[model samples]
Target: MPGRSHSGGVIRRLAPLALMPAGAFAVHQLRYWLAFAGRTGLLLQQQGHAYLHSVVPWIVLLAAIAVGVFLQALGRAFGGQCSLPRQTVSFGALWLICAASLVAIYIAQEFLEGLFVTGHPAGLAGIFGYGGWWSIPAAAAVGLVLAVSFHGAHRVLHAVADRRARPAVRVRGPARARAPRHVPAPALAPLADGWSGRGPPR
Candidate 1:
């Protein structure tokens, strides 16, 4: 029971913590951009492409792995058994969250750029351009798909685990029903002996 309870708690806690890597990666990217703004114009002009391509991806990858290890440790702590499928799901969810969060940040950056750099008129159109409005529906569709897929996968995992455990339960049932070695069995033993013609004297 404790194992089951602990596994449930682990799932609950790890699900939310799954978002941490993406969030941290985003913050790191933001910090890099901010620091870039402080560089000399010559350095900025020369190193912009290098910084984006080489440094950013590695930082994001490391952050993602760090978050993954943390979640795995939490899973182990709570007695949750990890398998390949479960790890895949966890990593898939992490990447999905990271992609979505980055898109959201980009959208925000678009609005900020328009307001501060382009001096756009403030309104709904400024927040999201007329064409950019489509992102809302696109994001909604993506979220729905991810949610349904995750729900189906979770159900399948539970079903498979239940099926695998069923055989063990069946195997243990007869063992439990077996008469205990320490239990006195005079009544049944005599019945067995009487049938076999080796019963005790009257």
Candidate 2:
């Protein structure tokens, strides 16, 4: 299992897909908890509305999942040559990518909302000018957390797969063929010539 430690079947590869959304949801909850520590009821209620009211969070989740799947596909095509430095760089790039994508999507959503309310949509700078820049750092922070979660989950899954793939140890020794249970005594032979049943020759 030298080279195959990181490699696995379909299930092992696809298992991490669920972690992407779970990480996103966990971060959202943490944000809610921090923002509304006193109002437990409102905080609990917001969880449902979070996804129902807006498409932004769902879109971000989908985008993250898509990126994860793409990376897994790439890992499969090439081998799982994920060294420590390589994974760090990869996830770091992922953090930047997710942050950029999330910010862009949020801006687009804001633009659409503005266009719906007012006839004209706000210009790009106007969108960023009016307190919209905050989204950048927030998204980047969330993206960083998600990237770390993904990396950790991947390592755990591969470790489990490697353990399961190992060959079982043998306990009993090799079997040997059985010897005959009983042996017959040699038959009595006749005496020298001219001797019958008597002890000595006639």
Candidate 3:
């Protein structure tokens, strides 16, 4: 596991994130069903009912994982095994991107679910009960345009950053132009008795 990488197992790796919520749901439902299976109803009488709301995000979590896995697979299968960005984004930008992506995926999911039966199946789609078709296409178009704009801005800013990172010519005043002067060393003092009191011997 020390040198392991997620790339080696694409779909196999995504399985956990994508299936966790479903698995949790299955277990939760199974517990309830089993509780009703007997007259005791011990499982249903269990506490922690307050935490039931916590499971609501499982669908959204699954959707986010699905989107990430799909994109990663797409990049690898054709885009040369692309990996996630190692750099961080601004807090606001990150929040906005995450919220927007989840909304998009949720909408698309609802649309797909509307098309097929109440069961599971591979698919794709979008939905809009109000504002007609205009709103649907408009949302998609706006998202696309924003994505393009963000990419362009990122590239331009990246180039500007690279340019500014290079060493620059810093001008200094005349007073500070010369190199620093060194301090003079202290002179040696006269020797005591032996050398000072007598002359040198042959």
Candidate 4:
């Protein structure tokens, strides 16, 4: 319970910070796809392509959830009673780490984009243009949402597992009848030469 309490507290405190990263990632991806579609006419030119591209963000989000579930299962199998809290902390940490990594990559991409300016560019600059300093906050928001969603899903899974594990059959037979079978004691052999039952063997 203490571990659960501590983990819950930490997640609550870090939720807002975590959301920034998740949101940033989501927005960045969304913008990238929209721009790509507009420039290439891929969405309009190809049947079903627009719809498929539109679902990319959802697919990515679901993948994140899958990762969370996998982590939760792993923790439960390995950590027993402390599984939930351990899983929650692990999921939160995963989001935080992912956000940090993306932020680093974004910065590097921005720098590279700036360095490679040319007259006949292929829109790499536009694709990597600075989306303002606000992307950091957006990324954090996304991460926060991911962590909270993972926690909620984890709790739901635990509840479902607990419900499914309840005993289905209850014993109600008579107590004496239900008692384990007992073997009768063997009849004692006739004592030798009038020896008493309490005395040691002759």
Residue 17 shift from truth in candidate 3, angstroms: 3.3
**Count of residue pairs whose backbone atoms collide, per candidate:** 0, 0, 0, 20
Give candidate 2 regions above 4 Å deviation.
1-89, 118-121, 169-202
Candidate order by decreasing lDDT? 2, 4, 1, 3
Cα lDDT listed for each candidate: 0.48, 0.54, 0.45, 0.52
Most accurate candidate by lDDT:
2
Give the distance in Å from residue 46's predicted Cα in candidate 3 to where it truly belongs: 6.0
lDDT of 2: 0.54
Superposed model 1: Cα runs more than 4 Å off: 1-122, 168-202
Candidate 1 TM-score versus the reference:
0.35
lDDT of 4 by residue, 158-185 (tens): 6655555565688887766567879997
Whole-model lDDT, candidate 3? Answer: 0.45
- Please report the candidate that would top TM-score against the real structure: 2
Order of all candidates by TM-score, from best down to worst?
Answer: 2, 4, 1, 3
Query: Pairing residues by index, what is the TM-score of model 2?
Result: 0.44
Estimate, for each residue in 18-111, the C-alpha lDDT of model 2 and write its tens digit. Answer: 4454444444444444545567347344323333246556757766665666466445434433332224457778778766665665666556
Q: Each model's TM-score?
A: 0.35, 0.44, 0.26, 0.37
Q: Which segments of model 4 are wrong by more than 4 Å?
A: 1-25, 29-95, 108-131, 168-202
Candidate 2 colliding pairs:
none
